[model samples]
Target: MTPFMFVTDLDHTLVGDDAALTQLNQILTQHRHEYGTKIVYATGRSPVLYKELQIEKNLIAPDALVVSVGTEIYLDGKNTADSSWAEILSTGWHREQVLSITEQFSELELQPDSEQRPFKVSFFLKQEVAASVIPQIELMLEKYKLNVKLIYSSGVDLDIVPRSSDKGQAMQFLRQKWKFAAERTVVCGDSGNDIALFAVGNERGIIVGNARQELLEWHNQYPANHRYLAQNFCAGGILEGLKYFGFIK
Candidate 1:
């Protein structure tokens, strides 16, 4: 098997319930010599979150990391390259609107007013809390900026990725940085947040049946995110995706 690299979302793609390293990691390990597969996490998570996972030994350490929604990139767990569109985040109404909403109503006392590089944003919230807050956030966001996109995942945690800061964009950047051809890259994920990813055609697209409707819609149009799986979530979906992609079999 030829070496193929996978740039995946960490929270849902590679990390499962109990924060267990997805069983997929063991599978990935098995194929390392045969398929030459290397994984890099392209996550909305911050470097601090990555370090915490490392300390807990919960995440499968990746060959590379695309952290903070692609604002930062690391190779060999060391900073190799980075780009900051802080000017965009700072003056942009999206950041300010988010700050305003969260400041006024969010139950979480997270850093919200920060208008600088490395915002260290929070990606999700507990379900009950989210239910109470998202409506207000949406109302405010609608009035302020439509450029930003919000993705709500199962944990009631919300991920605010610029319609631009998608895991897809990060994966594409990583693919070129490592000199890998687009045809050799594969992305697997479930959730509306993952829609932007299928926009890139480098590799196969695998979506689990449990994915959101909006995501399913994107797949229908592109026939790219059309790759679908039966597994539920976490390790189940990832394993199914790998098998469907013939990454394993």
Candidate 2:
């Protein structure tokens, strides 16, 4: 377990619609200034979105970003992704599968060329085999022994990676680059994709009230492990989390 580095999700875990910092917000700067504690937001947003947020002051210019769902990595406002990641996603056993899955479940039409799209093509999975993806997506992958990473985002969006792309991996990179101990890292969010990160960083994840029931029911990693917020929403949840951890006075 890490000493204590409070991190959170952006959309609903940290900031609310009123654009106010919930409990999480109040303590971020306070902890940094008063206690020398740091806070971070790990999101699916990309560099472009980060720039937009900086302009609006929605984000305090992240210390680092785990953005673009792992396709790209940026540090100090510069691209620092490992070369191998991009290279692998470009070619893999799952490329065709992901292409087919996207066609059926995703909004974008499945194309052989994912380069033209907003997200980079990490790999293609053969999604055409209809072995009841709903009941046993993981089992199917295991049966075939796929060599890829599967992640879900804020929405029902599924991401395919070459078994190496994940927020945990992204954080591990940032941890080394920044000289911060991985054990000291904590993450907060409200999505399934966030689950992997939580597992790796165990007891360090702060699940919001809006989290799915499966997570809510099973997450006993930390008692009150999840802070129930009165707001039941983003900003409110952030506020709740910050205060729950006593980040704010």
Candidate maximizing TM-score: 1
TM-score attained by model 1: 0.67
- Give me the displacement of residue 47 in model 2, in angstroms: 2.8
Q: Residues 1-249, candidate 1, lDDT per residue (tens digit)?
A: 677787667665565544324466677776765666778877655676767765665566687787765556677766545543333343343555565656665465453332132433454467777776777777766777655655565554465545555567667766776777766677766665566566756466667545666667667776644466546676677777767776677
lDDT of 2 by residue, 9-105 (tens): 6665555455555334454655666655555556655556656765665566555566656555555455565454456444444655544444454
List clash counts for every candidate, in order.
2, 21
Poorly placed runs, candidate 1 (over 4 Å): 17-23, 33-35, 54-57, 79-164, 212-214, 217-222
**TM-score of candidate 2 on Cα atoms, chains taken together:** 0.66
* TM, every model: 0.67, 0.66
